[model samples]
Target: MIDAPRSRYQQVADLIREAIQRGDYAPGSALPSQPTLAGKYGINQTSIGKAIALLRREGLVRVIKGKGAYVREIPPISRYAVTRYAEAVRESGTARGAFDAEMAQRGHESRTELVQWGETVAPQVASDALDLTAGAKVAIRKRHMHADDVPVQIATSYVPWELAKGTAIAEQDTGSGGTYSRLAEAGHTVERFTETIRSRMPTPEEADFLRLDEDQPVYDVLHTAWTAEGRAVEICVHVMPTTQWVLHYEWPAS
Candidate 1:
């Protein structure tokens, strides 16, 4: 039997994508005009257009309105692992240090901008996660995490207002080791954490913040903390862009 021949558009797309991988078309640089590409490939402009579309869908290139197609410029995401919150790491005295340590390894700096805060009636999800119901209020603190000034993740933490009303967790800056530290000081002393993760296409608002294509999805993480007494202390909802993230984890097989 004979192998089927590849389509012209696919062939062109593969060539261009390979060129990108080989750095022939450096990231952040414009590609040759569609007409020029069509001429070089000896194919019609429509074929060239389809080839370019293939590259765009695969995230190898982005076409800004009137800006033409440019190779996408970005570094791979740092692998995020749950172990970063180990006691030894938290001893560094800044909860954010866990994030900084990971990003620093890749030469990327991290920052968090306070986005929303204040007491509010708990959302159904928050209410269920934190053991609150019947319209109980929550102390909601939210922030946008960025890597080198590019927004990467949005996190909103929910704690029962009764426990957080006069605590440092309610403040803009939860001094030193951050919220977890404050929770400990207040006797919550979280003994472990549980994270539930899911993936879905970005909401219109999420797409705008993450600068993602319509096809891109985001990771939704529900991270919760609990004490030895089995009382839930904090529940944080995190929205992370899927393209720019990698997760690492380890466990003893036995």
Candidate 2:
């Protein structure tokens, strides 16, 4: 039996993918118009649209309304789960958080923008994670993080009001070691952390804020810092574009 012939859109997608790999279209650069691509490939505009759509779904290209499709510039950054939270890593006297230190190690510029900070009613997830009653007020610290100037992650942390009020943890800038250090100073002393991760399509607001395509998915990470005495001190929700991160983990065999 003979193999079936690929569709025109598939052929076009292959060509575009090859061109992108060959650097014919540089990353972050827009592709030619649909008409131009159709003329070049001798196909209809509808086929061109389908080809671009295929590329978008494959995480190779992103289409913007009225702006055309552009190559994705940012590469995937590795998230080292085991070492990122090591005491020495954050307390190395650099005054940088785990994300910043990781970025610097890989030669990428990183920045964290404090979007909002203050006390607020705890969301259900936070309430449960931190063992707070529903509708209880908590201190919130929200931040938008960038890698090489590209928005990549959004993290919102919730702390019990009793622990955060009048503390640096509620402030815009936490001193060296960030919130964990501040928590330690305040007698919380984080002994370990737990994270639960899941992936889902981006919401409209997330897409707009992260400049993501409608079809791109995001990793939702729920992180909790716990104390030696079994108290949950902080709960943070981390959202990151699926295309821009690679999660890494390691543990002892024994």
Candidate 3:
């Protein structure tokens, strides 16, 4: 680590990271509170706050705003040279396809459980990403996706409700199916999706929901699906347990 300025917050973050990398804190362990770190380093609370924020952005720790920080665990890299699982599965002869077939042969049912569904206007971030009015009404769907009933990911999908409103696709009886398939049936072909990957420790609530331990960190994935004509449509964000899933994506030769 470089010798940094006396910027209190960054110093604290560096100390914590050094301790972690040196195995003093160890993975999956919780660090002492801001006050403790502040006192130990003879710094004030505000500096500790800054240090924690830096760590959060660096993906070394995750704080639930009101909750404390915990050490983050690194997810397993795929044996396949891909970036996302969904894309890998779709591409022919992709490593992801072979892996999925093998997993299916062993009888792993990729299932989805409906968690939430409703209509609401877009928040600023979703609106900007989907290019909708800041408060324009949209349809929101949330699902807990699983592999053979084991919780694999929690995804929240947002769509312009006016387009699919009153249709069977947004009805309560769509059952446990993927939103992409349902949207296609509704005449909205999903052409492309962009995803952003980030790392963080799971919140206590998320840990319980996903049946993960304190040691297993979560991967936060934010994605947007667009139509072939270049119109942004559905926006989805998923929090997945890194220990349970591997995401792969393959790019065709240029």
Candidate 4:
């Protein structure tokens, strides 16, 4: 096996990250000061800062102005399938889903909150995801998913508002119903969903909204659900910080 060289800062950050992962520093708890970390590691405070920066990029810790760094939400390992939640619910004839079941079995409870719903997709990012022509109308749905009160995923979805207007699908809140169920009730059966996955650092705004740590890296997942006619009805993008999340998918045999 080839030995990989690691930097002092990386080594220090890994130590701190491991501590955080082991719940030594619980979420919302403060970490030691830069000088303390430097003293403990026998490195310069600058090196400590670099290590903390690494943790921030990995979504492990958030720095406050006077309060120092704090541990934030960490993701649960999720065993997932491409199958829609609605299908799982229907298959089991239960309101809860197989995905939720899997997570609960692992000692994590899944919770979702619908943040916003609107009849327009004004943002360029949302418009593109919905595959709308320039200035085309689209519905906007924003939601957050959590595991044990720690936010794990932040999602926003777009649907052609012109097509969904006056339909019950566009009016429901996250707690009242799921978008998939609403779409089915409104007579658009989702036949398939195509997903694209990527990763990047969260924007400052995203960091604030998702309460992400500076050391945390987020996974960006984009999905589009289509009907049998091949008309795309829903497009969703989810940003999840790595510490608090693992996106598992089982690929069907080719």
Per-prediction TM-score to the true structure, in the order listed: 0.85, 0.89, 0.53, 0.76
Model 2: how far residue 163 lies from native, Å: 1.5
Which one is best on TM-score?
Answer: 2
Question: TM-score of predicted model 3?
Answer: 0.53
Give the per-residue lDDT of model 2 (tens digit) for 185-205.
889998988889999988898
lDDT of 2: 0.85
Candidate 2, residue 56: the lDDT equals 86
**CA lDDT, candidate 1, residue 202:** 82
Candidate 1 per-residue lDDT, tens place, 1-254, comes to 98889899999999998999999999778999999999988999999999998887666777777868988765557555566676425546654566667666778777877877768899888889888876999888888778878777887899888888887777776678877878888888989888888998888888788777667778888989999999888898878877667776677799
Task: List the lowest-lDDT window of 10 residues for candidate 1.
Answer: 87-96
What's model 4's lDDT at 231? 76
Q: What stretches of model 1 exceed 4 Å from their correct place?
A: 1-6, 87-92
For candidate 3, lDDT tens digit of each residue in 51-89?
877776555666654668877544222323233345434
For model 2, the stretches where C-alpha displacement exceeds 4 angstroms are 1-6, 87-96
Q: Which of candidates 3 and 4 is the stronger one according to TM-score? A: 4
Q: Mark the 10 consecutive residues where model 4 has the least summed lDDT.
A: 90-99
Q: What is the C-alpha lDDT of each candidate?
A: 0.80, 0.85, 0.66, 0.72
